[model samples]
Target: MATNRATKSGFAAEAQRKVNAKYSEELAQECLEWIRTITNEDINCGGDMDNFYEVLKDGTLLCRLVNCIQSGSVKKINNTTMAFKCMENINAFLETAKVLGVPAQETFQTVDLWERQNLNSVVICIQSLGRKAGNFGKPSIGPKEAEKNERHFSEDKLKAGQSIIGLQMGSNKGANQSGINFGNTRHM
Candidate 1:
């Protein structure tokens, strides 16, 4: 029994080491520090920390953002329109982070994402929260809330369609009057 237990423990340790080897220890630690700072959670470099690294590797939105930042894919362009579009993407990403349980207000406490220099740091913070939150990050809405939203959208669409039809009818009336005016002017 002792030999069996020892073998099992050895295998577990080996598996952990392999997992740890897959991620950059420096990056993982940096991300953890940001997580601790933002969430005020007491996280360390082992135990639950390993789970953070695992989650970071799992390719969530935060992870993808980090990958984009790290790969130099997201950069400032000279074009104003492109820059505005980039800001829009960042805003959307931040909102998504908030929905995913990232304490976004606290995360941005020390840095502004609009500044290009702070983007990499922002990515680290987001990725850290994504790692810590795991499956809990997904936003949940009750079925009744969803149905209410659907009804509201349908009502808005119906109102828009009615307004468009009214505009078309008004334009047709103007066209009929213009035809009558043209015939009278020709006779005159």
Candidate 2:
């Protein structure tokens, strides 16, 4: 008899355990609440991975969430259950997130959410979106977004910068070769 994924012990199970360690229930609850409030629709999904995957697998809610963040981010949300259409919606949402300054590393692949391969990644993607919401002057779900600090340099500062070399590129401004000479140096 063949065992199902839930019972089978394998690499998938090990990976899931590792990811689960990093998953935060508090954050997930916040993400769900934010989604509901922003889209004005209650998500039937829960903090559980299985339920979360099932609801988001269709990608309709994800599209709606993105559109709420930025109007017209996702033009068409497929209501049909076709696999490709669902994937398209997920892909569109991810693309919109990237365009809006969400780091690519923080996003998930289509299969990660659709196939339930990595639901934690999906949560992380959602959390990243929440953090970025402030860019649009919208409410956020997770921690407050970090503000951008742009520094301005005067003409003198800019000229001084041209004459100085950055320390990263082997700029030996001070003493060297004082006590630790190697490679066939006779001892004094």
Best by TM-score: 2
| Model 1 segments more than 4 A misplaced | 1-25, 28-81, 109-114, 119-124, 136-188
Write one digit per residue (lDDT tens) for candidate 1, span 1-188.
11223333587677646643444455545665554544444546332433443333212333344323333332332223344554554555455556555565435422233432233345455554445343443322212111233434577787887656554455544354443453355443
State model 1's lDDT. 0.43
Q: In order, how many clashes per candidate?
A: 0, 0
Tens digits of lDDT, candidate 2, 17-107: 8876777666666678788888899676367665666667888999998899899888899998877888898999999999888899999
RMSD of 2: 4.6
Residue 32 lDDT, candidate 2, scale 0-100 = 81
Q: Please tell me which predicted candidate would have the highest lDDT against the true structure.
A: 2
How much RMSD separates candidate 1 from the native structure? 21.7
Clash pairs, candidate 1, are: none
